[model samples]
Target: MIHILGKIFSIISIISLIFAIFTGNLSQLAGAMLDGASKAVTLTLALVGTMGFWSGVMCVLQDIGVCRLLAKVIAPILKFIFPENCKKGIATDEIAANISANMLGLGNAATPIGIQAMKALSKANGDDGTASDDMITFVVMNTCAVSLMPTTLIALRRAAGSANPFSILIPVWICSVVCAAVAVFFAKAFALFSHAGYKMKNARDSAPPKTRESKAGTE
Candidate 1:
């Protein structure tokens, strides 16, 4: 589906650019766009090379079991964020592993590990109707996660000829951390409300229901 959408968008963009050229209103602008794309070719290659280097380094770390060890260290933190798993006695080791990889700014490495972790979490939940609170919370937590190092962003900025590559580190850290914290807090708040409601419904259903005749006779 994503590939199909990409193909559609690519065709649309090519058609729009051709239409602009044919209309003659965008002659100079089109020329400038072409120049920019030409200039970006070298920068794009540099960025890809940097990313590839870092990704390879991450792979080496993974092979050496350093990443798994790091994951074990952070498992407690992950368990706190995903309490339903704790309640269900479902291990989140793979998730912890994936998160540790992400923390090191290796999102690609984290993905397959996370997918496996999700499968494990689902199986532990033992039902298919709705995802468990832990699963939802984990999704939210990962989606807005605070990255330790913006390695890819820094690499891209450098490739784009920035004067200082690491200049934005402090600001990025502050903003990403704040956003991650807010996201996790909201997820936890919603999970709490959902759990309370579920428990309330369960209690209401389990208790004896009052009948009109029984109440009248008691009165």
Candidate 2:
């Protein structure tokens, strides 16, 4: 996928360059590129303090046992969503940490925690190449995670000179919840369908072969 995306981007860039040259807009394109690069750097620098502050807050929360408290609060819900993991008692802590980090809108912090959780889950699943139901569900949840405080987005808005940086809070909450719910629903539906198919295949494989006598009797 990464290779495919790289090729697509290269093709687009080549086409854009061709168009710019044909239209005698090469200088304009070059200027635009420089401007975009400058803006990217500026944005990165602006976000640095906000990101660092949130990261520090996350660490402080962990140190003060707030993360653990949040984990305990969400334990039942996690158990319900991840019965297999709960049964094995594997990856529970990592899963909780990942979820807590996401809720706090600490995506960068959540990423490493999420990776650890995935590793623990994969191990619990016997390290199978194929993703299990729990893995699919967890991935979906992580991708569409509900963020109670989208600090990164707020910081971007502020950097962009929004009159009210926090104005998106309500919309973000609604969108995240809806997205997470829909994603989980589809993941679960697919998992059930796959499980049913697997069972059918297993039953077919385990069934006894029809003998000549049985064929004759049926005829």
Candidate 3:
């Protein structure tokens, strides 16, 4: 459905563009587009370099001990984040580590690790089981990440030949921080709800043989 909607939107945009051109509005549209492009070039250039550079750095980090170090740093938080998996299953560990790398703006580095993590989680949970809150949290957490450096934006800036390439640093930081906070809050909230339901069920099940209700038949 999303793909179809996207196609429809694209077709509409193309038709609009064609109509504008036929009606002698193409020059104005072109000028407006060029202005927007010019403004974005700086970010584009910065982004390209940062993404590639950080990606390589992350790969090297994995090859070395940096990724492990990061995993270690985040382990405590991960434990709290995934209360159900206290013992660090291979799948859980991989998922946490990959997510940590992605948080550092290393999506490329996270790919194989993420894949490995998913397979492990699936195997652990079984084929019939759906994704647990931990799994969903990991996925959501990755999407609205809080990046320390706006490498991609910087690359875009550089590509666009911005005189002041680092101008968007603060904006990126603020945006990322806000987005990450919201994502994490939602993830934890959902996890808490799920955990609470499990606890309620367990507590009810374990409540000492059900007192008067079960004894009524015997009486």
Query: Largest lDDT belongs to which candidate?
Result: 2
Global CA lDDT computed for model 3: 0.72
Local lDDT at 150 for model 2: 80
Per-residue lDDT over 128-196 for candidate 3, one digit per residue giving the tens place of the 0 to 100 score: 578866567767877777676666667666776889889888888799868876887898898788767
- For 151-187, candidate 1 gives per-residue lDDT tens digits of 7799888987899999999998899878877888898
Per-residue lDDT for 55-98 in model 2, tens only?
78877877887767877887888887888679888888888888
Clashing pairs in 1: none
Native RMSD of candidate 1 (Å): 6.8
Reference-based lDDT, residue 11, model 2 = 100
Q: Backbone clashes per model, in order?
A: 0, 0, 20
- Candidate 2 lowest-lDDT run of ten: 210-219
Q: Can you tell me which runs of candidate 1 are displaced by over 4 Å?
A: 1-25, 36-40, 193-219
What local distance difference test score does each model get? Answer: 0.77, 0.83, 0.72
Ranking by lDDT: 2, 1, 3
Order of candidates by TM-score, top first? Answer: 2, 1, 3
lDDT of 1: 0.77
